[model samples]
Target chain A: MTSKSSRREFLTRSVQGVALTATGGLVWSYLLQQQAHAAPHAIRPPGAYDEAGFNAKCIKCGQCVRDCPYDTLKLAPTGEMVAIGTPYFIPREIPCYMCEDIPCVKACPTGALDHSLEKIEESRMGLAVIDIENCLSWIGLRCEICHRVCPILDKAITIEHHPRKLSKHARFVPLVHSDACTGCGVCEKACPTEIAAIRVVQPELVQGKIGEHYRLGWKIDTPITQEFKAPKRKDGKDTPATGLDYLNQGEI
Target chain B: MAVDNNTVKPDTVKLGPNGKPVRPFVMPSTLVGKLKVWRYIIYRRIVQLGSLLLFLGTVHWGWSIAGEPLLIGNLSSSTLFGIVPLADPFAVLQIFLTQHLLEQEVVIGAGIVLLIYTLLGGRVWCSWACPINMVSDLASWLRRKLSIKDSFILSRNIRYVVLALSLILSVITGIAAFEWVSPISMLHRELIFGIGMGWMAILGIFIFDLLVLRDGWCGHLCPLGAFYGVVGKVAPIRILFDTPTCTHCSECVRVCPEPKVLNFKKAAEVGMIASGDCTNCGRCITVCPENTLAFGLRVQSNISKKSSNKLESNLRRAT
Candidate 1:
């Protein structure tokens, strides 16, 4: 009788313990969900996946932070609220040096930072945007610093000539190309301005979202009309006579 | 103080049969006695604090030796002297869940760690390396000192349930959900980044263990510890009980953090401790007054059979 009562008590306690632990986990998950917004402008390490995918995949192991030779990468602190241990870098403080081997990507245990990114040029960490009004080059001061320090050289950033308002002297406008820029932030780090005129912005924050229904006709290499037309006859005719005729001729 | 009616001699000493004065509960009198009692605890603390200092020295202080960094890595995964790879199995599990591909180097590192734990009794990590253990140990000590009673008790199986839940959550959310709030990871970050909101997690666990439940976090709810417990179930090294020497004093039971693992009655019958929960912390061995408890190979059947043979021989001689 004692053993039976003890067994019943054990079962009751076990259920209570399990329920309590589950409740604790649920509470923590809910709290995390409440403060899920990460800093929008914090630049992730090179080869980091899109924001949602990155958050979903990164285990926050700090391997990337350790492998980074320049100390550019750091695990996001607890204050970040979302994906706290995930890696991010403040570009103005310490920019990526664009190492040849991409050690950080190699060190990543999870493919959160995609290991398939072979060359540093393939990295799309963030995009550099030039605040033209604040730029020294736009004020006709001959400061082409951002363009000169770009890892991709002329491809990533180019100095375009603009005539000064009152003089024939040309103002060098530093243009940043989204396609060529790796967003290593070397230019932002080297900026001589009190506050950097060129700053790295997270890709999701700067990149525009295209409408789902919108299709670019230029993307198709073949003529658009050929897609709707029936195939030519087996006799090697240039075009099918008609849809029914083409079907009848065994050339649908 | 009330004076007793019986007159007491000033130099009268009360001694046990072993010719030593009766000692207070769990308190060693001399420095040597304390050292003997706490040697394992001291060794574990040295290992835990040493590893933390080594990593911090390399990362935070930028301390290098002989033209090479002492150790250049963090807690989750690291390379010792740019050669040996040590990866946490929990982190590896998270990687597998998220990426579904195991990189060769990561697999190798995880294998190395897994093998070491399997051989050394997996809870070795808990008692020797895990930073949270140090905090929880302090809380346990404080709780004992204060004679704080447990307000709540959690079933040991809750840790296994937590382990399963974490894996399920990872799969459902496609994220390493546990890492976001894991006290182990948080404590490591706190060490490097200076304390932020992460201190709340460490403090919460300490307070929970101290005030609400005794040894709640590691003993009840930590999935990492549960995983290690499974790996360590068949560990070769364990505490052996010499039945002949045992006085049944139960002092070892009182000192043992996991008192259930001591099972003196069963140990007398079986000759060796055989519990997955046994952390091989050597506290029982230290506290055993009869010196019956010692670390030994888990050849329980053979040892028991030999003892039985000795009993038969003694009976035959008496006849």
Candidate 2:
């Protein structure tokens, strides 16, 4: 009976495998087309921001999860030894707002998240690009909300004015200046659309890299003041200094 | 020959005066019968059940409002709740070596208690008080209804492999995943964590045990069983049988819950009682009409064999 059942199972699996292979060929072509055109969606930065160091270094103590003020971080269930207690943020639901202070960086007890840089410019939380076709502002509506509310301001978000033909009453369109966007995703939240017309996109920037493009303006080194004095002789006599002949100061 | 109280002198007895040894001092007739049903109580199954009920009562009445009122409170996170101070040596060893449990000293301390008990008593914790063991024993009882008998060859050794993997992973990752293997986790997780794949995995193991193995997962391939077995060797306490009066009726062997590997008939030559598998249920003692059983502590080396003899003599005396 067991051998018969085994034979039946083998036959069933073989038939299913053949069917799946036939279906898989057609599905792959459609998937390729989708991949070619699919725009990158909003995603958290790839690396575990708080645990970038070597594996021997980590203890997986759930310290980062406890310290996170947003409570967005959670320890993965046990047995997932690879990525346990390393803090990760889910962006579409709870994207990093790119706070000027970057509280998570400060909260990390270990040097997992680098603590040296204080300014927002020093932070490299991936860049944000706007979806022009889906963006509400691009539809000739008055939506410079991203520009006005952008935390990084001109460096993180800017608007390009273009001629508007879609809106009956409008004459201009708001274009998202992608380079200026920090991908904080506030614009995604601000868009008063059912489907969130504007979205933050991925593969932009990561932490640890210096932002040479937008260096903080207040950090240049200042020159120190200097005092000038004439040299004195051991005999305590006033030495007469000359260009080629220092007559009184030679013996001392 | 000397004349004793109520006995006639043997050699000097005249025609009808040869005393019949005072009727051989026949013991009171009332004392010779099967022991009462209460003899079974010494096995302590009642004690285990009573404590289990009391624990359930306390948790039901108080745990919700008080929240994790026991050792390692609200171990709602792990695979198996490493409570029950007996099987915790492995857990504590991990903690001290890994430095992951320095802050949770109470839980580590509880693990130490289990280690100490293991050193002192041979797997008594598994037989008497471990909730998982109790559940497994209950599952064994239910095995009859399911028409399932455990055959080690047929059952999967996934739990042991998983246990080894979990230990290796804990060594590597500093997280013991034993809580995930627990049966209670399956029931509790739905209410606690909204029933994800983690709970489902535990449920799958339990279903497999109930349907296939019937004695649940622990009876066959628990690595924890291996862990307890190591500690059981040094356990001074054991259930010894008197070989002279054993009758080889195989009564004890028949009622034994552990496999034949742990049976006293197979194990006695090595001076072992049964093994870590012996639950001390006393089923063997209850069924024996010969009354050749009694529990006693080991004494002098000369008295080791004599102790079994003494136990049987006492049983016969009492009868």
What residue pairs are clashing in model 1? none
Off by over 4 Å in 2: A1-208, A211-218, A221-252, B1-87, B92-107, B119-135, B145-166, B172-203, B206-216, B236-246, B265-274, B279-305, B309-319
DockQ of 2: 0.04
TM-score of chain A of each: 0.72, 0.48
The lDDT values for all models are 0.76, 0.45
Q: Against the true two-chain complex, what DockQ does each candidate achieve?
A: 0.33, 0.04
Model 1, native contacts kept: 0.33
Residue-level lDDT of model 1, residues B56-155, one tens digit each, is 8877776777666667656677766666677778767765675455556666777889898877777777887899998898998899899999886557
Worst 10 residues of 2 chain B by lDDT: B71-80
Compare the candidates by DockQ and give the number of the best one.
1
Tens-digit lDDT string for candidate 2 (B1-319): 1112223235344211111111211223353333343345334566556544443433334322234322211122121122332224544343343334232433544456555555545456556644455555555556656667655443323334444544554454433433323344333322222233454545555565666665456655555555555566666566555444444344444444554433433333433454555545565665654444445443322254666557547767776
* RMSD to the hidden true structure, all candidates: 7.8, 17.9
